[model samples]
Target: MEKILVVSSNKTASETLLDFLRGSFKCTPKIVESAYQAKVHLNSDVLTELVMINSPLMDESGVEFAEYVTENTTANCILLIKAETAEKISERAEKAGVIIVGKPFSKAILYQIVRTVDIAVSRSVELYLRNARLEEKINEIQTIDKAKFMLMEYKSMTESEAHAYIEQYAMNKRKKKSIAALAIIDKLSEQYL
Candidate 1:
């Protein structure tokens, strides 16, 4: 199940919010009374999809916590603040990509914000995975290129010959071309070095 962390110093208010989240959202709600506790929850192995903070946590301001959450984690955050304070920090919240909900929020407002943030978190995760795959592909290509050069210079094989050699080795070993290339590079390095 998806997890959500709620930071609020007020016991009664936190309980109310927790109950509402449990009833309305399809997620596990974890409550923390201070920013420090929130950090502990965030650092745990479980991935949190959404974080909601009520302004003025026991040890730190909610805005600061929101900033930290946004910069350090992929989770999306919504900070509840007094209307006056919300106006003051609107720009900072926008820059940090945190959603700010002014105080005196109805349950409907909170639900909508959570829904929006959940969608954003999902998209961010997808993008992160896509980029990671692309990076791995780029690294594989570079390693293969370096191994090809090693074969050309050390084995006196032409470019096409070196390419074919690696491909054949990979097919015979049932390994990826990059893995075969890395093995060749390691063997050459061991012999020469």
Candidate 2:
């Protein structure tokens, strides 16, 4: 279930929103009265998926909390503000990459915002995972190249010959080329060190 942190001081509003979120999204939402309390939840390794910051957080505007969340965490945020403050709130929200939910919003609108957040979060995660895989591939290629260079220099083998040697070893041992390359690099390291 998605975990949501709600920063709001109004007990009635918080409770009402929590019920809506729970019923509509099956979200696990927790309420805090201040941005500081929200920070406490963030620092506690809660892995909150979304943060909903109600404008006029005890002593500060929700924009401050939203900005903090944007800078400090990967969680998506929805900043709720009064229509009168929409202009200011929207500027801050734009800078912080937060979604805006104007106060007195309809249930349908809130649900739509939550759905958009879910889609954005999923896309962010997918992009992150793809980048991680690409990085791993780059590292493997670098390691294999280093191993090939070592073989070429020490054993007087051509580049293709060194690559073929590693491939053959990997095939025979039922290992990946990256694994075989690491073993070769380890052996070379002992001699060079």
Name the best candidate (by lDDT): 1
> After aligning candidate 1 to the native by TM-score, how far in Å is the CA of 157 from where it should be?
1.3
Error of 2 at 177 (Å): 1.9
Compose the digit string of candidate 1's lDDT tens values, residues 81-171. 9999999999999999889999988999888878777777778889999999999999999999999999999999999999999999999
Residue-wise C-alpha lDDT for candidate 2, range 42-159, written one tens digit per residue: 9995578899988788868778788889889978888889977876667767877888877779989988888888887888879999999999999999989999999998878999
Against the unseen true structure, what C-alpha lDDT does each candidate score?
A: 0.89, 0.87
The lowest-lDDT stretch of 10 consecutive residues in candidate 1 is: 113-122
* Model 2 misplaced stretches (Cα beyond 4 Å): 171-174
Residue 73, candidate 2: how far off, in angstroms? 1.6
The candidate scoring highest on TM-score is: 2
Off by over 4 Å in 1: none
TM-score on alpha carbons, each prediction: 0.87, 0.89
